[model samples]
Target: MQAKHQLATPAKVLESYRSPLNGARLQQEKVENLALSEQIDQFIYAYLQFNSKYQNATADGKIPHPTKAKLLSQQRNKLDTELETLCSRSSSIFDQKERGKTLVMAVDEYLLTFLQLSFVGQRSPNTLEKMIGRKKRLLEFLTYKFNIIDLSLDKLQYQFIDQYYTFLLVQKNVMENTARNRCNV
Candidate 1:
């Protein structure tokens, strides 16, 4: 009765049904079939294959010791989590493209699109220059915060806005009003 109850628990039941591959086979197949243009996607596919082979080797007692196997498994799990994060970020970008949405991959691209669509001839040259200056400040902040000029819009969150505002005020030594203006842009 106790064994039945233990097996019936949600966690145990879920674990029992989960594939040992943890859907890596399906993800690998998808990666193989998709004509991935990004170099990152290709790297991810290679990593997936390497990870699968590593797991198989470990299971075949290549590691030989229980402790070392456990340690390697822990490290592998951490890498797997990071890989999943990368996959989700890249997949979301691809999905956005497939949906026929205007894909703005970087801050500068988004700024250009916004200006072209909304204020090309309507705004004065001075006003456009000021807008561009604001965008430069934003790009500076993004570079300081993320180390990358090209960031996916999908990865941005409310906390990013808050952090950028703080970065402008503290790191750039800008006034609160100026920080607010930069953030609003």
Candidate 2:
């Protein structure tokens, strides 16, 4: 993990983004910032444990047990998916409007497209409004957790489902029952 340039920054993220930096009144902002820091910590810890397990399995130049090898493969795939989900979220935000990148639809943009197809005409005005509000919050959480500001579903991973669940509980400070209701949306 330390050998990779990308992985090197994981530790710094937690420090830089931690809440209560100056002990000031922006307490809400600081609390909200916890999501990204926790994401980095979780990613690095998971990667290191996975790496160590893989290394120990083959340390003696012996073939891993079939079950161990299969488990390692599954872990490797999960880590790859997590890394891709994190890295792909980082794009040159500045180059887009200048380079005609705005013309290309992102996952967020597709939200409206799907809404039209699924709910716009079929649902009542109040129902459509609630649906849009839920989706907006979901997209906002995606941006917070993954640094994925655009509507890009390709950057999403199964891991994010759990991350978003935690984000609601932690950063959003939703009540247990309220979180269940919000998450179900």
Candidate 3:
């Protein structure tokens, strides 16, 4: 039937579907995808320019020898193949969430989520303030040690704890008990 065919169309199916996740997360994902797409476009433009120049040079006999020109052509072909493969694979990158692989949350984002949940659970304001203060100190240490404010959880190691403890004791010159509490936080 005409109505059945309309319902089966890709655009209609997408329009009728609703996602359970929050809008902010979806927006963030779209932003990341756009950035990646922009990067790919830039690479493709650069490749086209390079290919044009290579073709012009080959036609004008600017390349010194036939053997060298052949080598250069082979390398160019290999690069073109790589670009095509990348373009083909890029579509699946956004589908990683459906493939059961969890995306890594940055340290700051993880902390913010934790704080938000704690607040929603009616945690004491004093406790929340202490957590915020500790987070600030931890961020400071992270920046000092790695030159980064936010890091992926997978990048952390057991040594990070020891290093952080030492930083609190030595850099902040806090009491041992205070340093321990901060580390616990």
Candidate 4:
């Protein structure tokens, strides 16, 4: 009786965890993917440090430093290969939803890309997060109001953007500067 009761309790807990509309797991997966990308960046940085050291030694008349050069080259190759693998893995995680002949990405995918780019550019964490959050809100508005399925720059016309700004004004009651800042993201 005790074992059966314990099993039932777990089943009940799981029942609450699997909401059809809950995207927590999907978001968590995206965060994990972004963390992996950050790891790749660190590896690349290490490779760069090795390369810098090798370059400095070569500049100082130390020609053919075989061991250090070989180590740097190997590290760089490994980082490059790892980056490729991570990119492939990330792409595989995205679902292809056809929206008017364009592939629309999920919010998590787009946000993850934004985060990766920011990190690659060496942006501060606060700045990156702020920019990403702004872009996210804009994407949400486009998705909800205008049925905008894709976030292609070519797809964003002045008229649509104007309407979005108006939405921020009328619906969200945000300031003009805030709206402009969000669009800038």
Q: Rank the candidates by lDDT, best first.
A: 3, 4, 1, 2
Query: Once model 1 is optimally superposed onto the true structure by TM-score, how far is the C-alpha of residue 73 displaced, in angstroms?
Result: 69
Better model by lDDT: candidate 1 vs candidate 2:
1
Best by the lDDT measure: 3
Query: Least accurate stretch of 10 residues (summed lDDT) in model 2?
Result: 99-108
Model 3 C-alpha RMSD vs. true structure (Å) is: 20.1
Candidate 4 ranges with C-alpha deviation above 4 Å: 1-85, 89-114, 117-121, 151-155
Clashes of 1: 0
Worst 10 residues of 3 by lDDT: 99-108
lDDT of 1 by residue, 1-185 (tens): 24544547767667757865446754553453233324333443444454455567677567637776676567656655654665565566545543322212343334333333332245343444465566566667777988864445567789988998999899889999988987886
lDDT of each: 0.55, 0.54, 0.58, 0.57
62-149 in candidate 2: lDDT tens per residue? 7999999998999878777775564343233212443222211332233333333332245343443454455556767867966664
Instruction: Pull out the clashing pairs in model 4.
Output: none
**Residue ranges of candidate 1 with Cα displaced over 4 Å:** 1-96, 99-110, 113-120
